[model samples]
Target: MDLLEEYRRATMFFESGDPGGAARLLEPIVAAEPENASVRQLLARAYFASAQLVRAEEQLRALLEIDPSDHYAHHVLGRTLERQGRPEEALGSLRIAAAMRPDNDDYRAALRRVEARTGGRPR
Candidate 1:
């Protein structure tokens, strides 16, 4: 299949609650287009959804290395870290995401949750 077709199928799988399938379809695309931030983001999301937190963290960190200002990457990485029982580490990433996109309620909520867990005031 073509890249677009594969991407579409992977998205469909992800949206249909089959994240493992999505990850399978996206892995090759990610390998083939290592610099494609969008693809990497989707693959990272797929990994996260599939409970592959380690891979998700790796991909998100790589994406952040490529684009430090990516609010979504920070937010997702925060959530991933939280899921891994690392709320303290999650706080910094969530805070950065919330600060970057102050209007985003989801980001704010995530930041607040992490802050509360770490005994920090939610600003």
Candidate 2:
């Protein structure tokens, strides 16, 4: 199958609550295309679903290094940071994600949660 098809299959697995399966499918794709931000992002999502926070963070960080303006990477990193009890950092990343895609409710919600936890507005 093509890259997009493989990506779609991985996404379907993730949405179906089979993140381990998704991760298994995405591993080779990521290894084969290390520079593909989209594949890395999908692998990060799978890792997050499996509660592999460290791996997820690593993937997101790598994606950010490749493209700092990636909204999804910012969003995932924010979520991972929040889970790791770094509300301040989470807020910063979520705010960047919200700014990158103001219409995305997930980023906005994460930003709001971090704000509430920190008792401060976006910085």
Candidate 3:
């Protein structure tokens, strides 16, 4: 299949709660298009949903390196870190995401949750 077709199928699989399938479809795409932020983000999300926290973290961190101002990358990285039991690391990313996009409820909520876990202190 073409890259676009594979991407569409992967997105369908992810939306249908079959993140493993999405990850399978997305892996090659990511390898082939490492600079494609959208594809990388989707792959990271797929990895995260499938409980592959390490892969998700790697992808998210790479995405952040490509675009440090990417709020979504920060948000996902924060969630991935939190899932990996690294609340202190997660708090920084979550706070950056929330501060970058104050109107994003999801980012704010994540920041709040992480803050609560870290003694409700703004670090």
* Model 1, global lDDT: 0.93
Per the 3 Å backbone cut-off, how many clashing residue pairs does candidate 3 have?
0
Question: How much is the lDDT of residue 78 in candidate 3?
Answer: 93
Alpha carbon deviation, residue 1, candidate 3 (Å): 4.5
Task: Please say which candidate is ahead in lDDT: 1 or 2.
Answer: 1
For all the candidates, what are their Cα RMSDs to the real structure? 2.3, 2.6, 1.5
lDDT of 2 by residue, 6-110 (tens): 888999999999998999889889988999988899899899889888889999999999999888899999999888887877887898899999999888988
The backbone clash count of each candidate, in order, is 0, 0, 0
For candidate 3, lDDT tens digit of each residue in 1-123? 599999999999999999999999999999999999999999999999999999999999999999999999999999999999999889889989999999999999999898989985544
Clashing pairs in 2: none
Candidate 1 at 13: error in angstroms?
0.6
TM-score of each: 0.94, 0.84, 0.94
Question: Which residue pairs of candidate 1 clash?
Answer: none
Clashes of 1: 0
Q: How high a TM-score does candidate 2 get?
A: 0.84
Error of 2 at 106 (Å): 2.2
